[model samples]
Target: MSYYDVDAILTDAQKVPCTFELTVPGLGHLEGNPGAEVKEGTKLELPLWLAQMLAITPAGTKPGMITLDLPDSLSQKVTNALRADPRTVELRSLAPHFFNLGTRMLDLFEEEELSDLLTESFKLRAKELADHAHNPRGALGEGAEFLQGLDENERRLFRATHEGAKAVRAWLVGMQKK
Candidate 1:
């Protein structure tokens, strides 16, 4: 699904119970929560925002200390893919989601290597897209059909390149007219 579709759901997602027990009480109250006593050993169901914030720092920093759960490692298969050529990796099919997830929840996961690899891949792939847009063959060519199947995120990237190409192409035509 697109980010827009999931944004609302994730924004208002109910706080789920976590296994971590609080050593100290955090100031921010969860939604639907009252000023209940929050002492040590208190079990808390944290909202996504609060959980993300708490997870980012060391456990001892928060006066309302609590256990912070770390995310599991990415699958070995995914790790292998990150090591592969970014150009061959399909952005529309997989990379976009990985990049987005890793970016937003960077503190929660130890995927810095993977994120770096993906970022490089995006740069390479974007250059390829721009190059293709700058020099189109024809409507029936492979490039046109390849673009037809892009997901929204990929399409957005392609659209920017395409627009740049269109502007340049128009300028060339105007020069010829002049």
Candidate 2:
């Protein structure tokens, strides 16, 4: 997650559910009530950057100003779907930076199940992605649906794998000519 990485920036801009733990003055614009104070216990979907800061920053003796919850993308429903069939889940529909957001969330919350599930899902999906990438006709054929569901990182991996295979073939052809 480099400072200049566009994907990282976009991932940080993704919204996550948050509940205000303490009422503060003049912060209602976040909830679309400009010039009004955000009341305690108000729930809002805030960008990951803002929500993370507010959720971790301490106030006096209290822990923080807001409590952060998992975004809808990482909800129990999505988890169950991934557990059932990682290859079938449309990760891009959930979030463009699904894995990246999951990594960031894991940094904040400790969930062994989520951690293991994400790792296993990625491994499974990557194997499938590699297979599709290596097959020239796969993208346009039955694999199209799965390819379309790839998130940012997976898409990059697919492209790299596809291109690498192409390059290898080209090299082999040149060798044959020689």
Candidate 3:
């Protein structure tokens, strides 16, 4: 019931490589570009750290200076669905990874309707999770079923919320007995 599953989200996200480019000069060659110069229009695939660095760099902020291509087939679909109608997309189906990853790259993704839609969806789901947690004595309802079917990130969020609720209940019980 770790309230913050950022570590798990990061761990899963680290395995994936994101696409990025350098716009400004002087950033120099990165680990991925061995013996190669990193300049404008130079595209490279590296880990999230490198991509994140390039994204936040002073030069990176410049338009066309840095372009990030985050690949999430499902997210793209969800974004489209949300644009069509917020109700069309299932909140449970949206990956927490996308929410976390997307936030870091918001500058790049802000233009897409999906970013805002996903943000709204994530916040709603989080509140829903907290509500479910409060009912510790309740049976495994639709929420539990939904959680069971979630991907790693979604499951992690559910587990953390559920655990937090359990702990609070246990603490309350202990206090009552004292």
Would you estimate the TM-scores of all the predictions? 0.54, 0.96, 0.50
lDDT of 3 by residue, 6-98 (tens): 654463354233433544444445535455556666555555555555455455445433455764533566567656654334544444355
Task: Give residue 80's error in model 1 in angstroms.
Answer: 1.5
**Cα lDDT over the full model 1:** 0.54
Where does the lowest 10-residue lDDT sum fall in candidate 1?
64-73
Which scores greater on lDDT, model 1 or model 2? 2
Give the number of the best model, judged by TM-score: 2
- Roughly what TM-score does model 2 have, to 2 decimal places? 0.96
Off by over 4 Å in 2: 58-61
Pairs in steric clash, model 1: 24-64, 24-65, 25-64
Q: What lDDT tens digits, residue by residue, belong to model 2 across residues 1-178? A: 5789999999999999999988989987888899899999999999999999888854566678899999999999999999999999999999999999999999999988999999999999999999999996987899999999999999999999999999999999999999
Per-residue alpha-carbon lDDT of model 1 for 15-125, expressed as tens digits? 433444453444435433455445555556665456665545655665323443422223455546647755554444432234444455444556777677657756766
- lDDT (Cα, 0-100) at 19 in candidate 3: 36
Return the top candidate by lDDT.
2
After superposition, candidate 1 runs with Cα above 4 Å error: 1-74, 138-153
Please give the lDDT score at residue 136 for candidate 2: 68
